[model samples]
Target: KWRGYGVATADFGRADVTWSTQFIGKATDFNADPGDLGYRTPNVFYHNVQFAYDLFEKTRLMVGIDNLFDRKPPFIQSWTDANTDTMTYDLLGRRYYASFRHLF
Candidate 1:
């Protein structure tokens, strides 16, 4: 089982500047064979990042991101006619998201 992790930090001695980063990975299994249904990768990755700071000691600002890779499993393999080449049955691409939070 493969496992990993990462972290980043930033310090603002006086003003309030902060930055952070993170990454992780795990390759725990292998398909060996797909048989029929379709081929897939046993390895998957999950990662995210968050940025935050104080606005007025009472209010705070923050942003978060998820699914940095946005990878999807392949539903089909190679073939013609009996299988046919399709732009629809393949894997998905990367996705991005942005978010903000408030405190009460």
Candidate 2:
């Protein structure tokens, strides 16, 4: 499988904003054991948006949300003991974060 990202950003006054999107192309694992889920998986996409503001000459604040689409993994009922292949799929739908940084 192959994964890639798309990003865009702009600056406005004291704040800089950004938008990023990630894509995971479809893949097939022919070597998977018979007890595993399916041999193939569908493509998936995720999005994230963030904003960073200058709080001080040396300090900055940033915030963002990931998995904006809240995408769920494909269903797999035939698997041995797994509801969904969390190892090869995304389980956490959406999440958020905040951070502060200061440079000396």
Top model number, TM-score: 2
Q: Which stretches of candidate 2 lie above 4 Å from their native place?
A: 28-40, 76-88
lDDT of 2 by residue, 34-97 (tens): 4466566678888889999999998999999888889887655444555556676668889999
Off by more than 4 A, model 1: 13-45, 73-104
Candidate 2 clashes between residue pairs 3 or more apart in a chain or in different chains: none
- CA RMSD (A), model 1: 8.2
Error of 2 at 84 (Å): 4.1
The per-residue C-alpha lDDT of model 1 at residue 64 equals 57
Residues 50-89 of candidate 1: C-alpha lDDT, one tens digit per residue:
5666656556665555544554533333444334224322
Clash count (model 1, backbone only): 0
